[model samples]
Target: MRKILLALLVSTIGFSQNKPFAKGADVGWLPQMEATGYKFYDTDGKEKDCLQLLKDRGMNSIRLRVWVNPNNDKASGHCSKEETIIMALRAQKMGFRIMIDFHYSDSWADPAKQFKPKAWSNHSFPELLNDVYNHTFDVINALKVAGVTPEWVQIGNEIPGGMLWPDGSTNHWDQLGQLLNKGYDAVKAVDKNIKVIVHVDEGNNNAKFRTFFDNATRQKVRYDVIGLSYYPFWIKKDYTEVIADLEFNLNDMVKRYGKEVMIVEIGGEDDKVENTYQLLATAIKAVKNVPNNKGLGVFYWEPQGARSWSHYNLSAWQADGKPSPALDAFKE
Candidate 1:
């Protein structure tokens, strides 16, 4: 009876994972832009809700990032728990699946910087672990109360070097693994159906992915998905090379880890709109080509705002407030 019950539980957990081809976008800045009176328009120059425009373009999921005590840095306060919930509620109502990215910091949490939240700076290792658990649980609980259940949750963002600064850096894989497990456990505690993703940048770099996942596996870190950030321009690799490398990595990751993979974030230059379209289309194709349907999908990062609001030159929007043809790649 015990063996049967254990197998049933394991099967139930695996069955809860998302099976859809997650054509998504990381629109963490959307709510902040809307609050400042910015409106999105379609190619026809007709004003429309940003989420609706993406939905019309075939995007099925929205990824939002949440900061812990963003008030510690006023400029970085836009993605606070409350603001994320507001944006998430909008996406949920529009029938778009949601993915919550926890930055574990007051500001940006990327390869270059993953500063500890000011409130957690002085915490010991155990205290920091508890803080991570409590923050994740609180935010997820609040979102649930708001009637929004995120389909996927990223424990951290672009964490190629690991997160939470020196203590949880890649050199300290045990600590990093522990912190990540705290987050994974928190999400499962809230809802077992919500998949947890461990994200890293450089989707085409198989070496990096292997190293990170190897350490994670050694430490028994639990995760449901392998999320990657792919930017061809940053790597200075042309479209063909980028897609080939991405496909190779995606296949290897699935086979090695037995986990689903996704291009959690991707972008290209607006000046080269056609190239950007080709880039996105090629990436989606590469992901879909992963055998056994282990390739989940791709997500474009911050495609809505262009100039002043985001200053992202690679934005998938034209100057006239219309979505650039580059976004048409999602139609695939």
Candidate 2:
């Protein structure tokens, strides 16, 4: 019995030492895509569940985005709080680890625009702080009630300049820091084990990360992970050109901040399957190479969102309702 117990302990330790690197997709558009009759088929041309298709392609995690109150438009809206909960529950049921991305807006929120949700537009700075805390807590608490606890929660999405418009922008680091702390606190209030992430775009731009995180450090922001977005298609540069920079930034972020790093959002052009495949393979290798195992994961943004439905060129899904070969990189 003692030898058996010792062997079991050794196996458990080995499992922990080889924690599976997160290979995931942000399928926020999935619910809407299905509602609008967007079907997903595997390479064999059989209709299949989108999440299962992703899993078959070596994905083990799903990321969902939450908007405060969004319209029901098929393309650009309808990630409302309720929809998010439903989606998270579905993904959780499939054994996929979850990551919740809070956009904190009525519609889209990114580096270019982090508009205050229309409902909170008139709020004072203090009220805005309350809004952030209450909204984050409410959604996260609801997820908890529904028996789906996320493994990670992002306070904001791709917030390079910052979020919540003029108030939470980098121009007002103090206020931004306070707002971020509120979000961090809210997530902890619900589940202290849930890792909180602060996300920004341009993962390859070391200077951007340095400047943003330097300010975050000075302002004493609270977070457990650094999330980034890397899309060579948008920058109109080949992945070959930016991949080295991304690797450098990934390592530098861990060494500089002493925090885990994740490529929270990354996508290549759908039409360029071979190139995208190589890009993904190289990117995954770079992330796994981060020393001390601080590279937590990589998530492709909207990979299942076929261009025919979402009209997004960077998806990993082909127009024929099948996954592009590019996704096979995750298998490695």
Candidate of highest lDDT: 2
Tens digits of lDDT, candidate 2, 1-332 = 99999999998998787667899999999998898888999999999999999999899999999999888788779888899899999999998999999999988899889999999998999999999999999999999999999999999988988899899999999999999999999999999999999998999999999999999999999999999999988888999999999999999999999999999999999998999999899989999999978998999999998888878999999878999999999985
Q: What's the TM-score of each model vs. the native?
A: 0.92, 0.96
What number of backbone clashes does candidate 2 have, counting pairs of residues 3 or more apart or in separate chains? 0
Best-performing candidate as measured by TM-score: 2
| Residue pairs with clashing backbones, model 2 | none
The clash count of every prediction, one per candidate, is 0, 0
* Sliding window of 10 residues with minimal summed lDDT for model 1: 69-78
In candidate 1, residue 305 scores what lDDT?
A: 64
Q: Where is model 2 poorest over a 10-residue stretch in terms of lDDT?
A: 11-20
- Model 2: lDDT to the true structure: 0.93
Predicted candidate 1 versus true structure: per-residue lDDT over 238-312, tens digit per residue? 777767778899999999999989998899998899899999999999899888788888899888866657777
Residue 67, candidate 2: Cα error in Å is 0.4
RMSD of each: 4.4, 2.3
